[model samples]
Target: MHVDVIPVGAGHITQDIARGLLTPVDHAERLKTYYGAAMQSPTDDREMIDVPQLGETGPAEDITSQLPRSVLTGVIQPRIEETLELVRDYLEAGGFDGIGARRVVLTGGGAQMPGIRELAQTILGKQVRIGRPCRVVGLADATAGPAFATCTGLLLYDQMAPLELSDERQTEAKEQPKGRLARMGRWFKENF
Candidate 1:
């Protein structure tokens, strides 16, 4: 169970908007919701997003502006490529030698974006699948997509207790090599 965590996330889209937009938009929370919907089915055409009370002092008025799809795709696609590249580098570096290394399971809000699976497969030259919570009980269908994966995983993790080693096992662990591989193995054992 060798795992590599990449830091790129949905928040990056909001950051990109702040930097890439011609006119500054200060409402990140609203923008996240707006852009998140747009990302679900991205296209080449520009979109109009309406923001209410866009000004600081004037009476409430909705501001409609054009948001180019390139803004979202430009930020997202490259990050996905970068993530796959990192995984490739890890495999080449001999950090991950697990079974089914060529198969990638993408989970999280970003995974639901249209074309992401195809893009990842093309970039990684591997099979990629959107991950969902499996073997979960009492999970609503509405909340069962990749967006809720982290939360479901956390709930599952909460039920797990730390492994307790016996004196003999502790002695054997103490004798193991203190290296990167050893640490990773120990972590895998502890968590999984």
Candidate 2:
């Protein structure tokens, strides 16, 4: 099952706090760094050779190996630890009991992060997973990844809404018996 993981910003806190603190630029930069770090997977040179078969090929550094473990453990891991703690708190506080959730979805481009789902599951204690758009008629390739999930979901949402008043009025007009005056108006509209 596909899952959508939305981004959390200062806005996730409270509107007042969000408005008081981070600006749009700050929020954007935070999201960029969060997503960038999440996508970075540790791989040695040997692993790089195998990646080519999957369409990934380039000079790469094994971040896990290259970075000092002390620094990573002190800084990186702590941040992840903090975030996970926050997620746990949020879920408990919000009361999101995992009922009928087959797979927890993490969507958005950020969902592509290498081990985020595992981290999230560990923290949230749920059957967590990532979600991607799939199996649409015209939007097959366009809605392929987590990044496109929101847009694809929105398009699907629009399709499911009831007809507007304008549409209902038009349908009513189509179904009604046309008097001579209405026919004359229709003829004039068509000719014009």
Candidate 3:
């Protein structure tokens, strides 16, 4: 139930795009941001994208245009599928019992990709939707997406949270009999 961290976050998809496309991390990331999709579409074959291929050793200067949208899909889709599968396992262990989530809400920057919800639905067998932050008064539109949900939520909660008594107050109210022998003697006296 405590599957906290695995190789399944938005960054993994970026890394996959970089390694799989043999592009520099920067360019791969740019391509991913600009063009990456979770599934293949009709335009995938026709449209082209410039993938940075560092030729031989140091070809950062060369900067050649390469590959199509489908290549990005080929690399990105598998990684997405793999990450979700691991997530499925984690969910199953964490009391889901393989029934899967009725509705999967994807958050963060990764969820912004094209066709992501559909891809998640296909692999996870659930209705998928992109989640954004709401119900917070005066929250900035820029910081209102899934990427900032947890943080914004905490901040909002903190503002509205009620104060409670601390442990020190409760302990201060009780009598503190110090030594172990004294405590045992008091217990015996009370019981006897």
User: What's the TM-score of each model vs. the native?
Assistant: 0.61, 0.46, 0.73
TM-score for candidate 3: 0.73
Q: Let me know the TM-score candidate 2 reaches against the reference structure.
A: 0.46
* Candidate 3 wrong stretches, greater than 4 Å: 1-7, 55-62, 97-101, 135-139, 163-192
Off by over 4 Å in 1: 22-43, 46-61, 94-100, 139-142, 157-164, 167-192
The parts of candidate 2 lying over 4 Å away from their true place are 1-81, 98-103, 140-142, 163-192
lDDT for each residue of candidate 2 in 69-187, tens digit (9 for 90 to 100): 22222223334546557666655555554564434566665566456677778767788767777667877685688878767877877888865669779897789668998889878
Residue 159 in model 2: shift from native, Å?
0.4
lDDT of 3 by residue, 1-192 (tens): 232445477788888887887877887788888998888999899999877685545566367666888988989888888887876677667766455447767777888888888888887777778877776767677887778765676687777896465889658536656689978988899899
Tell me the number of clashing residue pairs for each predicted model: 0, 5, 0
Q: For this target, which candidate reaches the highest lDDT against the unseen true structure?
A: 3
Model 1: per-residue Cα lDDT over 48-86, one tens digit each: 554333444553343445565555455555656666677
**Cα lDDT computed for each candidate against the true fold:** 0.63, 0.49, 0.76
> In model 3, which residue pairs have backbone atoms overlapping below 3 Å?
none
